[model samples]
Target chain A: MIIGGGSVGLMISYYLLKKGVKSIVIERKYPGSGNTYKCATGIRASFTSKEHIALMKRSIELWSELRDELGVFYERSGYLWLLSREEDLRTFKTYVSFQNELGIPTKIIDLSEVKCLAPTIVIKDLLAAVYDPLAGKASPFDLILQSWRLLVEKGCKVLAGVEAKKILLSKKGILGVETSAGFIESSTVVLATAYDTVKLLEPLNISVPIEPVPKHAFITEAYRDLFKPLIIDWTTSSYIVQTPHGNFLVGSEIPERPSDKLLNRLEFLRKASKVWTKYFPWMKEAYLLRYWTGYYDMTPDHHPIIGPLDDLEGLYIAAGFSGHGFMMSPSVGEVIADWIAEGRPRVPEALNLSMSRFKKGKLIKEIAVFG
Target chain B: MDSEKVIVCRCEDVLLSDVLRAIERGYRDLESIKRLLRVGMGSCQGRHCLPIIARVLAKTTGLRIDELNYPSSRPPLMPIQLKYFVSDGNEG
Candidate 1:
């Protein structure tokens, strides 16, 4: 049984179907229409940690093959970050070492190279950049719907608009989950509901160290040559990427505050305008097309908690992706599926993502989370 | 804050009638109710609807409004355009 019908749950259901395991996906609302719909679908593996880079590498592979395998729209326009400060460049060098050691193919390029890649972008304060030519974007709606279609075709059950109330457990180990519709008898339960997992499991004294933090993003009206690749100003924590339809998708990180308010801060737009103008003075005249807000399911250390918990048997969690869950959902789905079938995650480092990490004080740190 | 207004979720344009229907169907928690009717899951990030819906829910369920556990309000307290939907690959 899978709780939460977002991309992670749906992808797990699809993989479970492939493994000959029929699972029921319980979504509180229209499945895949929750936080997954609010995600900025960036598929990048240029992380500053070993495990993240490895996991995201696998996710990127799945993303590239989705065009033919799942028949969805995915583009590999690459992600470029402009590093301006000396200390930031130094930290980025270490990231290069870690990412390179993990086989992510991330390269540190100079200002001239950055200019050639995105000539419209101003690199006046550039120290260097970390470029992942493989990083790109996709449509969250398309990925979720296509995965749902595949799940339906495979005879897996998707019960949307149905909320799971609790996980009914027995002393012996596994029992079933109590959902809004009724009770589902299943030995295995995967919580892919992100921060919601905390509230659902809190009644049972199971503490999931995940919190919802507010984030914002807004785009400008379609402009010709708004930049081909995703250009990020690392100093200001702002980024701009042209969509497949020629519009400029822009956003920046606000300090993570423990609030669920989904209001777009006007200051975000104002600061974004200043930052964007500083980088690309030519875009100073660009008018806003639309603006939206969402939240990130942030963990203590920015690493997600995957695998089954020791406190409860047969209860698996694949949540706390921070804000980067969408890009890793494809790979995370397979990881959860493998764990359910084979009794372990496909990636060995996944052990660090378990709930025990918090207790053991073995937090896995990612240097480039908001990046 | 308008007691006479019947809005439940201004972000999605949900109404008090729809929320009343959801609570009538045995939905108790604010999280479940939000999922069912998107009450506080809108643009104002529940600043406008949170207290109102919680008050109505408290009256219906006999639980204190503060006693109810609700999901966090998401960001962008305002509405945005759909043109940006085509690509959000780097929202991280």
Candidate 2:
């Protein structure tokens, strides 16, 4: 059984069903109504964390095949990280070499070469930059929006509008879950509820080390294609990407503020526009259309805590993706499915994301999250 | 007609296929693609080749002109104050 109907939940269900383990997914709201839909929809394998690099690599492989399988256009675009600070330059430089060592082929480019590569960008203040050509962006409208239907078609039972109250753990091996409607008996439970994971796992004494960070994003009206590629602009700390509908979607990292409130603040847009214009001066001509807020399932370290929680039998977690769950869900699903079927992860190295990492002080550091 | 061999990322001396293969290898996001292929990390900051890359991605993905990912943006990776260069003869 799986709790939460977001990207991670549905993806886990998908891989489980593929392995013949029919899963029942419970969602408090309709699928894609949460942060999964509000995500910036950037998928990439350029990461500093060794575990994420492996998982993202495998996840991206699945994403590539999923394009044809899902009948959706998971298109490829380059993610160019412009560096201005020596700190960022050094971080990216180390990441490039490390990524290359892992077959990622990331590299740092020079100033003259930067001009030749992306002339659309105004490079008057660039100090250095890192280039990863194998990154991409897909529309949540195209992928996550259709998750419920696709999941149903794939033989996973999705119980929408139903909330999992708590895990009904008894002597009977995680007896099942108590839901709003009634208790359903299941052998195992997988929590993919994002920030709500804390509440769901509270009964088991598992204090989910995650916080909900409110983030804001806005999109402009559909305009002619003026830009291509998802750019992480450090000066603005915003991720700028144009949606499939022609809207220029922009967002920035905000401090972690866990709350039930998800209101778009004018302050967010006001600052975000500064970054938008800083990168794309042409956006001034475009009109702002819509804006929304979502939460990032943040951990002490940016890396997510996947795998089973300590001392919890038949209970697993795939939460705390730190706002990057959508990009990594496919691989997370593959790994979890493998673990369930084989009593071990398909790749043992993935155990690095285990929740025990915090206790073991084995935290994996990641650098190429936004820039 | 040497478009294939023409430089896409001058920093890495990447060709067109180098950029396209970045996508094929599961680095579909623009940031990873650009960084991996060095398509837009050169001196011009993607000014010369980004449009070409965008056009190709749009065509390859069946996305309309508007459907492509927004072009990458970054602070100028250049134009550091000449004063910084004039700093106490440290290394240079």
Candidate 3:
């Protein structure tokens, strides 16, 4: 049984079905109605760590074959990480070298090259950029819907609008899950519930480092061929990508605030617009379309917690994705399923993703600006 | 009724009577009224409805209009068909 039918849960459900494991997904709200649907849908392989790079490589492969494997729309629009400082340029160059070693083709391009790559980008202060033609975007809602249909076809049950109140555990192991509507008997249970994981696991005394922080994004009125590629500027923690529809999908990190309120703060809009204008002056004239906020389940290391809990025998976790779960869901799902079915994951290093790190006080430190 | 006066969000179609009813319901803040009636979740996404909703909410709640916060915006800015979104073309 899977609690929370967001991208991770839904993807794991599909993979489990493919492996002939019957499963049921219980969601408090509708599937894809949570943080998954609110994602910026950025798929990128630019990471400072080996594990993240490998995970993203696997995810990118799956995404490329999604149309054939799952019959979903996946695009390869590429991503460009803009750097304005010498230190950032050096860091990106080191990362590019590591990526090249892993057979991931990433190039460190000059400002002129960056202009050629994305003409709409304001190249005045751009020192260098790491360009990966493999990175792109996809719709999380569509992917969830398609996966849900496939799960139904495979005879798996999905209960939407039903909340999993508690995990039924005995001395033997997890008996099943108790939901608002009823109970289901299962030996295995996975919590893929994103931001709510911390709250949900409070009863069990599992202290996850995850906190729900607000992130906001906006779209500009459609402009004719304004920008290409997902442009991420590290200085501002701002990312902008022109959708196929010609509207610029833009987002930036907001100052941390209390999590319960879903209201859009005007201060965030002003800050985001300022960043946009700094990056692309031409965008100043673009009409503001709409803005929305979503919760980011941030971890101390800015990496996701993906493995099982030592205290709970049958309860596994795939939450605390920081802000990058949407891009990593495909690989995370496959890895978790392999671990559950085969008794060990094909990626042995993924076992390090267990909650023991937090208990042992071993925090993985990386230079992540947006988390 | 004037075309501009049409209420799109049925939950908060603030007739004068509805305002009095909200006051009777003991709502004393614009935010409280919006929460109760969902005055801001329509297709216009609160763009055309919020000013009026705020006014009614303020009058009924016995609060200054400036005290009321603006309603938030939701995503999909302009809702398009799923097919159009999934298709590999540049049209929106």
Q: Which sections of candidate 1 miss by over 4 Å?
A: B1-92
For model 1, the local distance difference test gives 0.77
TM-score for each candidate, following the candidate numbering: 0.79, 0.77, 0.79
Candidate 1 vs candidate 2: the lDDT winner is 1
> Candidate 1 chain A: minimum summed lDDT over ten consecutive residues — where?
A282-291
| Per-candidate fnat, comma-separated | 0.07, 0.00, 0.14
Q: For model 3, how does the per-residue alpha-carbon lDDT over B1-92 read when each residue is reduced to its tens digit?
A: 55345553553354555545655644444433453454554345566667776776666566677666454456556643222322246633
Q: lDDT tens digits, residues B1-92, model 1?
A: 44336766676677787777767765566765664554554445567787778888899889877556655544343444332222235531
What tens digits encode model 1's per-residue C-alpha lDDT throughout A204-234?
A: 8888898888877876655666556687888
The DockQ assigned to candidate 1 is 0.06
Question: How many clashing residue pairs appear in each of the predictions shown?
Answer: 22, 62, 0
Evaluate model 1: give its TM-score. 0.79
Residue lDDT tens for model 2, A303-356 = 887887668688889988887898888899888888777777875678988889
| For every candidate, C-alpha RMSD to the true structure in Å | 9.4, 13.4, 10.6
Which one wins by TM-score: 2 or 3?
A: 3
Off by over 4 Å in 2: A111-119, A254-261, B1-92
Which residue window of length 10 is worst by lDDT in model 3 chain B? B79-88
Candidate 1 lDDT for residue A103: 78
